[model samples]
Target: MKKAAFWIAALAVLGGLQLFVRDIVGAYNYQILVLVGINIILAVSLNLINGYTGQFSIGHAGFYAVGAYTCAGVVVYGQEAIRGATGFLPELGQNTVLLLVGLLCAAIAAGLAGLAVGIPSLRLRGDYLAIVTLGFGEIIRVLILNVEAVGGARGFSGIPQLSNFFWVYLGVVVTVVTVHNLVQSSYGRAFISIRDDEIAAEAMGVDTTRFKVLSFVVSSIFAGIAGGLFAHFTMYLHPNTFLFTTSFYLIIMIVVGGLGSIEGAITGAILVTVLLEVFREFGAFRLVNFAILLVLIMIYRPTGLLGSWTLVRAGRRPGRAA
Candidate 1:
């Protein structure tokens, strides 16, 4: 009953904020909130592979681009078809359903891309895996650059703005909860075992390669969903937007937040988003400031801002000393 009440209260608060916050706040602030939510999803999803599962992937942007472009393409071209299929629903309901469907499609597309990349690449470790993923990311960007159907280098435009606070926040919530649950499960232990020592995990019958691919695929799914929301929110898609540099930003978020920590991911995402905005005031000097701050963080607290601190840990009783 207490747990139920807590959930009910949480849902009520979320519903109230989603339904009323935008109306009360300025558009700029509301948009920033939405972006933060999206980043939380991205950072947490990536943490599954890079932190919990212990894989270093620098090609998340490739999956992100895949999701964004696929979603935008559907919105721009498939609306009529979707409308026909959902003709029974009211106009607003139809649009909402289509948007959700588009997001799901984006997730699937990115997961397939992850599978293709992961099957062969997961065999390698460390720098080899990183190099392969990086190359994959570049390949994706190049493909998008030459694909004139999706606007090539000119950029895809005229996408409708279907992303709202509700959807973005809901995505964040779902991603966080799902990842948190996964990390506490037996599969999560296998992932951690692989991360700690792949050979030992394999000898123990953990199926390291399979779990690695599964982690990558799950990470890509949420990354894709984040990309879909970003595409709709910005109403534009550009291949350059998902460049290696974007992936670097994501890495920085997780690193600064602390790998293997969901709370850290959320905190780091929000912190980085705000810092980016704040640094924007410095104009050309923003990157310089950002770099210096990151360097300082590395020097002082190499583990990250949260350093593996988890919200779940806060509620648990301390273990007895040996």
Candidate 2:
């Protein structure tokens, strides 16, 4: 079929590019690619609840951090001194079962945290909801700071670095495909209906509350998984990693990328991630640039760079550029 050929050609192009660019790109560029994957997952997942399902949730970082810390704890406790004895990859591969279990546990912990926050907070709307979610994020951060067992204020050290671009991009591909399918399916139709008009959606027999919770829980699970990958890849994680600043960056990504489009998510993630990394050497003023970029994007092209484009769609187009 055309779709199969499209995917094959796209893969060929990507393979060629990897061969050509592998020697030229720096380690930091690979890091950026990893970040791109993470941000894509984060932004798209948030979109499920906020954009597709029409809910306001600012506490996403809380679940993100929960997955991260939970994963780290398992790896640390399961391996114990092996963390100090060797590195993340060594300890990680030796106990593949434990690692997978750790990741799963991380997702469960985070999804539960999402339910904890969503149960009460999802009741509120508009500004009130934002405040509650924001509060939840702050509570998580402060709690992490006080938990001495996880290294608390000083941060956790010795996390393994087993994540690579393959895992990161694989996550990105999966997140996009998964959310895309969800949106285009029956449940996704309900989600879109809710977004269009909640009162009407419920009047039409859609269980708005149940669907909202479902979307929130699903988003949190994937976001948590991304966080787990992040923690392991970077090998160092702290409460500060999931602070308000992180939430802020993620918001920027969603805002800059069209909220409803997976392509927008990818475009925004790459743009913001690249901007932050490239300008990080600028010190405090780097953030100033970020703010300015946000302002300009909002003012000029608020729909996000790609708007509604999709890689699969692009692949489908006859003679489309690779």
Candidate 3:
């Protein structure tokens, strides 16, 4: 009952923000909130594999790109087809349905990509896995660059702006709750076991490989969802947007927020997203300022601000070793 009340309160707060706070903020600030929610989803999801499962995947951008393109293609091309057949655009109800369907397809598509990559790649650990995932991200970008159907290198545009505060925050809430539940479950122990010691986990009869792949798939699924929301919010898709650096940014989000910490991921995503906007004032030194800020943060908080600490542990004691 307490947990139910917490969820109800949280959703009510988010709903209020969407319905009222948005009216008080500028368009740019409102958009930043949407980005924050999306980033929270990305960081939290990635933390599952990277922090909890002890996997280093640098190819998350690949999954993100796949999802964005998949969703965009569906909405854009489907809209065209409908217009061609009926000489009118889709109604709001139809658009919402298409967007939901597109998000589902995005998740599935990204999960498949995760499986394809995780099958062969999970065997390799550490830097080797990172290199492979990095290459995967690059490959996805290059493939999108050459695909003329999606506007090639120029970029894909004219997508319906279906993403809004409601949807984005809803995704964040669902992701946080779902991932929090997963990490607190028995399977979550398996994941933490793998992160702590794969050999020992295997000796304990935990199917490390299977759990690793599952972690990767679940992480990729949410990343894809974030991508879909972003695609619709921006109403544009650019191959360059999902570059290796974008993946690096996400890595920093999880790292600076705290590895193996859900609250840390959320905090880190919000801080980084806001700092990114602040750094824009530096003009040519934007990246330089951002790098300095990260370096300074790492210098002070090596394990991150939260450092794997959660506000409330679910049915367990706090400070359990990860």
Top-scoring candidate (lDDT): 3
lDDT of 1 by residue, 104-189 (tens): 88999999999999989997766666888799889999999999988999999888888888778878878987898887788887
lDDT of 2 at 256: 83
Q: What overall lDDT goes with each candidate model?
A: 0.86, 0.75, 0.87
In model 2, how large is the Cα lDDT of residue 296?
84
Local accuracy of candidate 2 as per-residue lDDT tens digits, 1-322? 9977755765665556545454567776767777788888888888778767777777788888998889888887776554444454654455554556667888899899888777776665445557877898899889989998888999989887655565556667667878888877778778777777778878999988778878888899888888888888898889888987787677677768876666777677788888888888889899898888888887897566655445653232211111
Clashes of 3: 0
How much lDDT does candidate 2 score? Answer: 0.75
Clashing pairs in 2: 88-160
Candidate 3 accuracy as TM-score: 0.91
- The backbone clash count of each candidate, in order, is 0, 1, 0
TM-score for candidate 1, please give it: 0.92
